[model samples]
Target: MIGQFPPIILASKSPRRQELLKLMGIDFTVVLKEVDESYPSGLNPTEIAVYIAEKKAKAFDESIRNEIVITADTIVSLDGQILGKPETADHAFEMLSALSGRRHDVITGVSLLKGHKLYSFYELSEVFFKPLSAEEINYYIAACQPMDKAGAYGIQEWIGMIAVEKIIGSYSNIVGLPTHRLYRELCRITAQ
Candidate 1:
């Protein structure tokens, strides 16, 4: 699987994304390129995710050789509002409080860039959380330090273990990247 596709350059610093790519048995190089994640005001959840992903991919110019550049963005949308990474502990607590006993959508958009050509797509997963107490939210926030994660929580962390009630769609999407869809898309692109 590693050698099936052209060399891949993953343009992200996310450990979760790195782990997912490794789990897929794909050989790729990690290259971090910071890009503004701001999106148009009217874009929906999935669109915002894909837009940022493609924006990150475009950071690399046409000089790239045979390497395929991969970039991804994940966003948590609750009632059509995006819950981004919390900047402060208070904010994290607020995000967690809003998510209590509610179903939210987690969408991740991925972009694959080869030289000047680009491909992009997105995946969505619905996550339901059991009603959480203020104590539980604060405790989880203190323990997990979810400031770096969207929706102020990691689905693979302690909060997810006790708080997540159920999920529909790809679990990996909620984790960060949609590996199954990514693999299939990579296969399709490499086949050509």
Candidate 2:
């Protein structure tokens, strides 16, 4: 039987991530800390995501003990451009407009730290949006408050319910964390 893992510390403020972890039956504590999210200019989407997640993991002091510190970064990439959180409503609208009836990649990178050892991995989900109207976008944004979400939208929101026609990878990745892979990795780490 799978047993409980060591004490885990999640370094994220995302309600979705928290809920996902709880849904997975994993016991972990939230430990928020600010880390410089900026990355090098030449990095790809997965690289950028992993870099930031590892950076957040590194923010914890080296004195950390038995607890496993977890950090993650999610990025929405369309074409070759990275779409972060929307700065304003108009920005959200613009992002939604561009994404309408298009396909984009949502990548989430995760890092787990125990003492000085670190394990990092990334998951990519391709999302396909149905043709959406300006009114639909506006209404969804007003109802869901997606300004803080990457890609200006959340896959579990009303917009996702209506606009997301298909998904090619982990649904949890689009939600901010890749739960299945994370659970498997945790099992491996705990077994060690």
lDDT of each: 0.92, 0.92
Task: Give the distance in Å from residue 112's predicted Cα in candidate 2 to where it truly belongs.
Answer: 0.4
Across 1-192, the per-residue lDDT of candidate 2 in tens digits comes to 664889999999999999999998888899888788999999999999999999999998574799999899999999979999999999999999999999999999999998688999999999999999989999988898898898899989899899999999999999999999998998888788
RMSD of 1: 1.1
TM-score of each: 0.97, 0.97
Poorest 10 consecutive residues by lDDT, candidate 1: 1-10
Worst ten in a row by lDDT for model 2 = 59-68
Predict model 1's lDDT versus the native.
0.92
Give the TM-score comparing model 1 with the true structure, all chains together.
0.97
Tens-place lDDT digits, model 1, residues 1-192? 444899899898889999988888888899887688888899998899999999999998654888899999999999999999999999999999999999999999999998688999999999999999999999998898999999999999999999999999998889999999999999989888
Task: Give the lDDT of residue 179 in candidate 2.
Answer: 92
